[model samples]
Target: MSGLNAPISCDLLVRADAVVTQDAERRVLDDAAVAVRDGVVVEVGGRSGMEARYDPGQRLDLSGKMLLPGLVNAHTHLPMTLLRGFADDLPLMEWLEKHIWPVEFQLTEELLAVGARLGCAELIRTGCTAFLNGYLREYVTGQVVADCGLRAVLGEGFFSFPSPMFPSAEDCWKTVRDLDARFADNPRLRTAITPHAAFTVSPDHLAASFELAVELGVPWQIHLAESPSETAMCLEKYGKRPVELLHDSDLLGGRTTLHHCVDVTPDEIAILAETGTNVVHNPASNFKLCSGVAPVQAMLDAGVTVGLGTDGASSNNQLNMFRDMGLAALAGKVRADDASAMNAQAVLDMATLGSAKCLGWPELGRIEAGFPADIIALDLGSPNLMPVFNHVSHAVYAATGMEVCMTMVAGQVLYLYGNFRTMDIQSLKTEAGEAAKWVLAAAGK
Candidate 1:
């Protein structure tokens, strides 16, 4: 027995049927338990072994559930949750320029906060404990996420031209600086410098933004080669593709997280792998917008770190990572014309460890010793998850987000058995409804 002489003290102990540790070996321990102390995972092993090792202040028994690392949403516009289904059946450019931008013009900080709270609740209920969000009003969104007891890499969206949020490029920079300062010491939140996209952000502004990102030591995020037209526009205007433009601007590196990348070529894929740049593939959003399927299989084959993402609620219409995992696997097989392409395990990893890499959060993904106690439990007793021949396969192919019964971040239980512990879900829904109505009316939609 561990601590045979003196008993060890821990904050919490979680016992489950199986602990799916996505570690180097990807071990799934039956009758496993995890010991957490001060928000860190102290031990993960057999239940009996952990029980012998430590005496925990609180105990949670999930006997029929499987414990896994909390799902990580690599990319999203969380405030767009209020705009879900606002505009649909439109192309990317048309959707943004014609429908989305007009509605965003009427957005307020309060609306953003309301939407963020709803998004956080949805994410927690669905087992997502962390996300990388790129959107406007990030100051409000970041605070709301922190208050909701989740982890996030919140990025303030910037554009070369004036928008409702920022009257000028300088104003945008000021907000970025302020956000960086505010979240410098925050444990649950980090700031990123997010340029809207290559086509929308001027070259000068892009360069400056990247410089600022490097200075702040934060990840640089941008939508690159999301569509054929965007790539063509870059080639015509700058005599380079979006990837090449980033490379020339000194923005292609380990700290860059490029969203979509549906229109990239083989050469660009090589560049991405060479630079160790991360990619977030939003299969559902691409399909909804009629954007081409991303070259995920090829990118993976080339050794590029690609993660799955739900782009935004307005485009994806949902914040569920389970749906994204299923779609990613199905889309990769269809795109590659091979049954072996993008296996279930790979898709699950994308939603967890791979997505954590995109956010530069090395300690947030895996359920291992020394890692954060950010984890979720799935109801293996659910009908769809019955006959659990393979937990990982079921997680990616059959299970939906609704199967998530409990979600915990850093030893803090944020959701349990359809109940939220941090935020009031009913109040958030009411606020989101009012905000949506106000925005739609202001936009004359």
Candidate 2:
């Protein structure tokens, strides 16, 4: 053991003007610092206290910045970055069947990886250190995420019908098994069981997938009640609403995340809370597609765990969690017709802690000691962030993703000042540009 007087060695010491600790107490410390060692936060306290106690290999002085835990994207299709702006102003089913699905079917494995890598760049740039992704060719997406040093839970979303990647429903399960095995020992990567949704995936398959997720002790995510049409279709086919179907099937639980619950009723909200099922609110995508706003305030009031997410770039047009955070705050107020609904701090919390809970990562989305050092810095020097009355307010209301100056995952700086430390941004952009052309042509867009 080291002597009492000796300064403990740490990998990095990050000092900022203020640290927003979204802990249970929601403490905001001024002139605070966080000490990281081996990807974990070893200490977090006043800057002078940290400086006096630890010797850091590297020091990051974010004097004009506010530090917060890195944002978590609870639900996203990372590979859909290639489909951004490819389809817009259409309903969810029309958007998917007429444009997104066709284009997705044409995406080669190489293109899928490229799109996922580009999405990772966007995520890192926008201060997201971790994401829960559902997409095709998820192994490729997982490898890209692993190489880029971001934490992710990747799942291959499958339907009752054969997909481009999987020839049969059985084949999809085999792929999930392979993914679970491949990422079993990885700290930064894992796999989820993602049956597409009630509309596209049969009840039997959804149950089987849920069982596999339970057997592997992994999260089970699926798109649910995204639009009115989905609810109508599910009710027409199964004599129950989407959430009710899942609840009846015993699929609603703490480890299950239902994305885009835009059409759920008050009863459904209560059901979600009672079952401990998590929901991801995708405000931007929902609005863009003309899907009614989710009953977020009702859900919150009923004690439902709600996380914020950018559904996919194809529909949302961006993967920036900050954008979604702002939208979630505003949409909730608009939906509830009360300005106090989904306040700035509440939305910010949804993006971080709530999203972490959705992913079943208890140790993530906080800046406390013993937590992973997944943190981000926002440059308070920006004009939009001027005269900051409240850091949390500015973070959720005023600051765009441009204010993010640094994004770190597990003590590793993946993005800083427009520079991606893990991936080649320029080359990836070029390849994505080419891929977009190919996708447009293939989709006859």
Candidate 3:
């Protein structure tokens, strides 16, 4: 054996009756096969072509499923999965002030870890292979990601409030720096500078975050123009729109990752596209919060690298990218009055290749030859996916998370036959249940 001490041997060859490679051509092959070794796709073609290729130690038969690239969550608060459905049916500001903030105030490091394990499990269960996460707890995120074997860009939420981990802004900076150093060598993890948002962070702090991101060569992820109230607040406080404030602060660039441009203008969209600033659209969260739908078609038309994200469970109530894609198409159709505004194939790309670009990962999205063997297969026999006339349309409009039958990331099978391979589901459930009780108790409910 080699000295690398790898987690698992992924000499896996996965075959399916229907394989839809979300590649340059949007190709889908019937009676297709894929060869994976050492965490990357080596071959993808007809079954005969793959049979002529190098043999594998294992094979997954997915004859009745439609295989595609693993879904990517471009933005989310993973640890908030425990808080799913805890608070709902309110506007953004009131919801934050009355419920989310108060509950967050009592979260402990252990609780965050417990919640992250549960979130990872949920993501795996629903075929989400990679996700970007931001939370008030940093070390916990790093540890859980490393242990759970998921791709993540971890960022500690920083604000003016006295958080549990940091007392001052300096303390928060120091903590994030330490986290960055700790995960510097981890391949499955990376670090980002998250300032929460414009309304929560001071101008000086926002500038510092961008500067630090530049210095450290990490992406800066921020919430911007998420709601009209946020826009109003930015104008009142900084005499400019949220995007303008960010652009003025020199924070809009290739290394900048913005969540929700729900209320941005055409000019701001142009600036973002020109600067190569990546934007992630959370259609579900925006709709739930009554935040106006983002001008996604306009941004895409302007050549912006856009992706899909579920936001967080507290707001989204789920971390399913398929659900997010369905919502995106629904919202896009209603807002643009074009039923084809965001179609199934397009939303599928947004979850795979588009989401990868937003996350600064160029090589981890598609199922093409030489791409990572990150893939998922959904059962087509289900009622939602039955009588498949158009595979793409069926996936975007008819499919649901409950139909996911397999999830593979980095050539490793994370979930199959309804069993998680890497994470301990029972332990996570037990720990998460206890932690949720504590969080609720601390919230005095």
Model 1 CA deviation exceeding 4 Å by range: 1-3
Writing each residue's lDDT as its tens digit, candidate 3 over 1-445 gives 5344433233877888788888889998888988888888877889766765545788888889888888899999988877888889899999988888888877878888887888888888888888878887767977887886778888888876666666755577777788889988987788888888899888898888778888888888999999989999989988999999988878889888999999989999999999999999999899888898998877887989889999989898889988999998888878778877877777888888888877778676778888878888889989878787777787778888888889887877888878988888888778877887887787788
How do these models rank on TM-score, best leading?
A: 2, 1, 3
TM-score of each: 0.98, 0.98, 0.94
TM-score of model number 1: 0.98
- lDDT by residue (125-230, candidate 2, tens digit) is 9999889999888889989988999999988889898888777677788889898888778799988889989989999999888888999899999999999999
Worst 10 residues of 3 by lDDT: 1-10
Question: Clashing residue pairs, candidate 3?
Answer: none
Against the true structure, candidate 2 reaches a TM-score of: 0.98
lDDT of 1 by residue, 32-91 (tens): 999999889999999997887778999999999999899999999998888898889998
lDDT of 2 at 350: 93
Ordered from best to worst lDDT, the candidate numbers read 2, 1, 3
Model 3: residue 119 alpha-carbon error in angstroms: 0.8
Model 1 backbone overlap count? 0
